[model samples]
Target: MGDKVISERLVGTSTVHGRTLEVHRLTWRDAPGLSYDVVDGATGELLTVDESFDEVPRLDQLCELLEAQQKIGTSSPRP
Candidate 1:
């Protein structure tokens, strides 16, 4: 996939992994869950697209997921 435009309506901003990120809330009409896009603060680059969240998570939980994304990005592939 390619870069996407950031949503005009953003839920909030979060600070994680020594970098600031923009958190956006996306709701699907067909499903009963909400998805989120964690984008870089400075650049509009997408850091991660966190979905499959059955329900809206608390700030701490969101933080954990974001951190996990970072860890996955940094870690080497294992056999």
Candidate 2:
């Protein structure tokens, strides 16, 4: 299934106990539904499953947090 990015946003530290979050929007044709997945990227591990759009919002929130953490880990440390 072809995946397309629909929307993305950042979850501020205030919402994540002092951590930033990166929320992504994806659309797939085969599934024909809204879903979210969290990947380690560093290890290529699938941290989470394909969550449906209607259930709970936790998946989306978690993904956002993961993305934020990844960004922080990859960027150069401030002196």
Candidate 3:
């Protein structure tokens, strides 16, 4: 099934592992849940797309997810 975007907006910005990231909240029409997109603030590149929450999470919880993404992203070996 395809999911329709219900709402999407930038929640806030944070510096994780020395990289600036733009955190966005996204809701879907077909899916009754919340998702977050962590984007690279400088290059406008999408770094992480997490759709793991069944309900709205506290700001701290969101931060943890974003930080985890940052760690994962930064740990990858670059050519």
The most accurate candidate by TM-score is 3
Give each model a TM-score.
Answer: 0.52, 0.34, 0.57
Candidate 1 per-residue lDDT over residues 5-79, each given as its tens digit: 333247787776676767666665555445665666776656555343444456686577667877786322211
Please identify model 1 stretches exceeding 4 Å from their true place. Answer: 1-8, 47-57, 74-79
Per-model tally of clashing residue pairs: 0, 1, 0
Regions of candidate 3 where Cα sits further than 4 Å from its true position: 49-79
Model 2 weakest 10-residue run by lDDT? 8-17
lDDT of each: 0.57, 0.42, 0.62
TM-score-best of 1 and 2: 1
Question: Could you give the C-alpha RMSD of every candidate to the true structure, in order shown?
Answer: 7.0, 9.0, 5.3
Which scores higher on TM-score, 2 or 3?
3
lDDT of 2 by residue, 18-71 (tens): 443233345665555555444443344443443423322474566564565556
Residue lDDT tens for model 3, 11-34: 777776566766777788887667
